[model samples]
Target: ALSMPHGVRMRRIILPQALAIMLPPWGNLLIELLKGTALVSLISVADLMFQTRQINAATYLSAQAFGTALIIYYILARFLITPMMRWAERLVARRLGRA
Candidate 1:
């Protein structure tokens, strides 16, 4: 058997396992946080939804403004965060020899 330092063992072994277990929920949390940015706009943070609301105010196009923001958020989650999380999960599973 080979001896390994604590950090090395954790990095090479434990983290992968933990990451596999944590990734799904973490991905959900990320998407929720992304959606939560709309709420953040209530505090004057100037996020996407904030700009969407501004567009609505100026153009009086509530449906178009909010719908565009919704589409943007869905695209981000579908194309970006979801894929990234799935890739990470697959990478960790592959490393753990469980893929």
Candidate 2:
């Protein structure tokens, strides 16, 4: 048997494997949650969708306003969220000696 404390075993053995298995699905869930934030506009929260609606009402430009909002969401998920998730997954993999 290995001579290690419980915390050391967990940190060195369990967590990396768990994180590697979990990270991909977790990343997808995060992006989905970000998109779901637009629904908060229905409750009168001043979110991106709400701002888009305001722009649409003022200029009567549905495509432009909503399109811009779509682009913003895409940019956030693609540039920020996805990369961060990939980095975390790689870090976990490296820690597990699988990278």
Clashing pairs in 1: none
- Model number with the top TM-score: 2
Candidate 2 weakest ten by summed lDDT: 37-46
Q: C-alpha displacement of 79 in model 2, angstroms?
A: 0.7
Which regions in candidate 2 have their CA more than 4 angstroms from the true location?
1-8, 38-46
Candidate that scores best on lDDT: 2
- Per-residue lDDT of candidate 1, residues 1-99 (tens digit): 159888998888787788889989999998999888664465576688779888999999999999998998899889988999999888878888997
Q: Candidate 2's C-alpha lDDT?
A: 0.88
Give lDDT per model, in order: 0.85, 0.88
Q: Could you tell me every candidate's TM-score relative to the true structure?
A: 0.79, 0.80
